[model samples]
Target: MHFHNNGNLFPLYLDIRYSFNAQSLVPFFAGAGGIMLDFSELDDTRIFINPSAGIRYVAANRTAMTFSTGLMVITGGPNARKSFINFKLGMELKRKSL
Candidate 1:
């Protein structure tokens, strides 16, 4: 998902993240994504780079929580190059053993 001056844009994005300290209580990760934002007026295609870093923690009950923050560089139509910060939080629950 992408946000810019016009509004929200649903573009195809690909990103990869690397994590450190897999067995630790708290893990750190960094990732970067590439996306193309289309401009109808300018009739051009622009590539936006989104980079972020985050931390993840797993509780005793096997519930995981993650918090990430990144910046999205959007290059829209003419004279429209902006940068916005994006923050995301996620949670995951694991199933108990039988």
Candidate 2:
């Protein structure tokens, strides 16, 4: 889950993910959805949906490198409904499975 804002708009989202079993370069898929709101008024809210795909590489110390890309669809807002492509890169710590 994540929240982002740039003074004018606020975006809140949650991602459902699944990782594939692999020795290295694990691939995953996610479906995400949430709301985007104009900061000035509560009435200006848009529902957003996203489906994403990514790959992950785990390091020796449990740190993982991740790269992902997706498309986001925003509906029902004051502005015209729109869609955009998005990309992200980040690192995460993974817990060992019991």
Q: Which ten residues in a row have the lowest lDDT in candidate 2?
A: 1-10
Candidate 2 C-alpha lDDT tens digits along 1-98: 22433336677878798998866789999889988777677666778999999998887678889899999887875667788899989898878899
What are the TM-scores, per candidate, against the unseen true structure? 0.66, 0.78
Model 1 worst lDDT run, 10 consecutive residues: 37-46
lDDT of 2 at 45: 71
After superposing candidate 2 on the true structure, give the runs of residues whose Cα lies further than 4 Å from its correct spot: 1-7, 94-98
Q: What is candidate 1's lDDT per residue for 1-98, written digit by digit as tens? A: 54545744556667787777766356565655555545443344555777888888875577888889998786745557778899989897888899
The prediction achieving the highest lDDT against the true structure is 2
Displacement of residue 67 (Cα, Å) in model 1 is 0.2
Q: Count the clashes in each prediction.
A: 0, 0
Error of 2 at 34 (Å): 1.0
